[model samples]
Target chain A: MPSLKTLIPAIAASVLLAGTATAGDLVSYKVVDYGIPSSLTGKAGDAAAGEKTFVNRKLGNCLACHQVTKLSAHPFHGEIGPSLDGVAERYEEPQLRLQVVNAKEINPDTIMPAFYRTEGLHRVLKNFKGKPVLTAEQVEDVVAYLKTLK
Target chain B: MKTNWNRITLIAAACAVCVGVFATSANATDWGPYQVDDRRSGYTYMTDESRAMQVDSFQNPGMIWVEQGADLWNETNGKAGKSCASCHGDATESMKGVAARYPVYDEKAKKLQNVETRINTCLEKNMQAEPYKWESKEMLSMTTFINNQSLGMPVDVKIDGAAAEWYEKGKAFYYERRGQLDMACKHCHEDNAGGIIRANTLSQGQANGFPTYRLKWQKVGSLHRRFRGCNKQVRSAPFGNGSDEYLALELYVKWRGRGLPVETPAVRN
Candidate 1:
């Protein structure tokens, strides 16, 4: 087994990120800039929880458009974006977080919705007007889960 | 020797065809890019269980709504003391092919009108009757009955002339990504038709079998109801029935499914 030194930080980070965005976390409404490194302040992320959010239809909804081999057990992985089978082999954690934050920044015409940023959208549904798809810590959780593919 | 060579070539060709079929089935929606829009009906993607339900009028629950619609057709209730039959005579004659040509331009209103709205138009203008609410059982029954009059007739809505602009708008809407999930109708219906989405096989989103009896809903539903459900799934606010945006969309979608045989009271999962 790997030393607790490495596993402890990741474990503690996941715990911290587990409750990062409680219902009271209204700071998600603030102006969030894309392409920022670790824009989520000091929150930690849980890969297991991130995996749940990644597959949840109401949360990330990422499976609706992207195919991920890690999630093959879950049917209907979409075909819109590149396969996320070996995503960690392609990009670093920070880069993955940036993509999750705002993929349109990399390619303006990309159909992937920004999971963290809040502004510049069209006709946001009334119930979800001010909410982002994934909270900041949730984005980190997804990034952590993705990083494990390698 | 020549005959043997010919047989070898024939076998190679058969193998190629088999491979092509396998690719489509195995990959489902994994095609490289969206180049053309496929307009096939959702019926092609249905499960055998649902198909059995759709084909049997005895098993199809939509027939219940169709029966209710027939009853409403002859009943006179408006202040004008006129039923639908009174104004139009036999539906098989007056309403024949009428449903096929709808979502047409209304020059007086300068808007696209659908079957439900057209019913409302006559109710308020000719009969002075109260209009049915969107997705109400009464409207579903009436729309299904009128659509059944066009059953087996090919869908043939106009996408040109005054409707041309709305058609373009709807085309844009189909291709344009919207909602928090940022999905376009074409992403699933056009580009990924025949692919499985969770438990449901994705169809081309054709309107041919609409006012369809959805086994999921356990009730008959209008095309707009299906549209609204899709919008909500993508985390978008659904447009109200007969609204301008949706009416234009209906025109575009109907045109997409042009020539598809009508399957009103059709069943789907």
Candidate 2:
């Protein structure tokens, strides 16, 4: 474990990154084992807004793979990933947070995109370079919404 | 009466056990999700209206481009004052089954060449004309016309000999992840081929119906154009229309759709 001296700069950098982009950036996070133990935005996300983000075609698009029976009102919930019917019951917030941030960390072969990571990506277009697919807050929002699946 | 009831119960229990065994085996197979059991063409995924549009030549918007190409074939241009008709003559006889065998290993160029490149090669060498820009009206029309000749012919691109190296490269490219989405072609086209992504149903990304008239574009477009669009969707820097990368990838994709009838100028949404 490093001292607060080493940690302070890293936290400051994340704050600076978050400040640069109003709602989008690759904010730093600490991954412990198979999960990120805290909120990426350092605050609880809005569950309502998270649900909207979850179903939004251009945003989370979690429905593109994982089916959520609660959101059956929306057309075409894909079967590529396991259904998130009782996802909240299966995993804690931390585990879900890590899964959203970068599922490749948990399962390397997973087709799921890393929603909050930008490093080591290949041939990213000019407009999306150095940008995570989902913002830190969006990641939290998705995690919050996912927690409501129970 | 009691014996008959017991027999009925035994038969019902056996049926239940059989169903249980079959269900577990089916679940264990793991066809990657959505379980696409057979190869399907992009046409199968399109709406009925789109399907109808492809079948009727008079109604098919691509037929317009095919007609345009026919006119271009006979029109003389460039210093040689030669039209495609001068050398090739009747295209119906000569160009038949030509597109199906293309993206072939060009011995002279020492690389793979698709129908588009082959067209340009003839324009430069035989006609002494400037090569039409890829995605240009002339190129799209010409390819649509040429590919139409092989409408029902199965794609049979050679992957052996010198073409073998390119094939391996293409296969690697299909599986290798790229872009901000970090998706390989296989992630959607293979693993989730029949699955829905938003409103759109993902096809196997077959090349059987290329130089196709897509409803989204509202016009005829080349295979390379579609490739660029997919790469862009994944937030990856798109390669050039006729780049070596796309050529190799195309060859690989064509191989995947081998035995599927060519549906050039086919309508798609």
Candidate 3:
């Protein structure tokens, strides 16, 4: 059995880790030439789950400003942003990853929200202050889903 | 996977009851920072049933509070022993065209003031009465009653003079990115008006129908209240009601509908 001193530190370390997770601390990555060339979770995402997030209003809500021709059964795709049809054919996976993570990096004037960024935002509500709108895994999932457009 | 898609489609259909997918007027008119020529009131975006309620005075829920305001206008309750009616006389004659041009830059206050702020100013300075709370039933009733007098009149507010600086600030506020969403007012209301966001149809977000009876709230609410709600929805800490930010925004938004007729106590979903 471990000593109390050792046990206490172990418990404290886990508590600290849990707090960080709950606060939605971002998984850091490097952007090389406007693209993140790594998997956020170091594993491939499920394209099927990504499709659900694309449509869920309370989730990614990409359909709010994007149109996916394959998802036409879902009504009222917005026209403000360009349509997402054949997007994968135009860009590779790394570029898609960066776009989902933070489109503002590519286009400063773009109205698209940074789904995986938390810093430098204004007047964020108390509960949402440190949290990115989508989790890093969700961002990967969205990128994975975007790849299926081809 | 197929079942999940089916469920989402079902939910989308349910939302359609409140959100009509019809396109807005095709005429594109150029306005400051916007090219939407199809200026339709928020009323144009509401469901048919909600619009019907606004047309029938008997069935309109907001008329209930307006009737109460008629009584409050006459009952004297202040150190001055005066009522809004005592000085303004019959609101029908004294208040017409007043609400239509409000959120006006008050030279005395040195700031813009909406009908709610104006009402509170009167109660404190003129009547020597405790001002009504910003969202109180009495305040909503009074503003609704006052604005009803100006119903169908064009919204005509001045942005020239000292008001011009504040108008610029309000315009900046409308375009600046805000909250966790990083969206400006223009993202939805300007760029995507008449488009669906989930199940809700985005309107031009005009200020014509204010102190409106919203089915979502199940009661009449002031424009400031709606502003706070929109801020919160974008995951931003909302400014307080009657704050300078909202007062300036009111001026800017009311100016956006400069030619649309006022639809006070308007019904909305």
Q: Please say which candidate is ahead in DockQ: 1 or 2.
A: 2
Pairs with steric clashes in candidate 1: none
Q: Residue A110 of model 1: what lDDT?
A: 64
Best by TM-score: 2
Once fitted onto the true fold, the runs of candidate 1 whose alpha carbons sit more than 4 angstroms away are: A1-39, A42-44, A63-83, A106-111, B1-37
Classified by CAPRI criteria, candidate 3 counts as acceptable
Work out the TM-score per prediction: 0.79, 0.84, 0.80
lDDT (Cα, tens digit) per residue for candidate 3, span B1-269? 35798888889997785455332233333232122245778877778788789879898998888898888888897899998988999999999998789988888988888899999999999999999998798898898899998888888898999888878888998998889988788878998888776567889989888998988999999998998998888888888999999988889998998878888889988
Model 3, span A1-150: residue lDDT tens = 999999999976765654112234787676777787888899988899999988898779999888888999998887667889999999999889988888888998777888888887888989888889888888888889999998
DockQ, each predicted model: 0.32, 0.60, 0.41
- Chain A TM-scores of each predicted structure, in the order given, are 0.74, 0.83, 0.82
Alpha carbon lDDT of each predicted model: 0.78, 0.86, 0.84
For each of the candidates, the C-alpha root-mean-square deviation to the true structure, in angstroms, is 9.0, 6.1, 12.5
Per-residue lDDT value at A107 in model 3: 94
Task: Report interface Cα RMSD per prediction.
Answer: 2.6, 1.4, 1.9
> Best candidate, lDDT-wise?
2
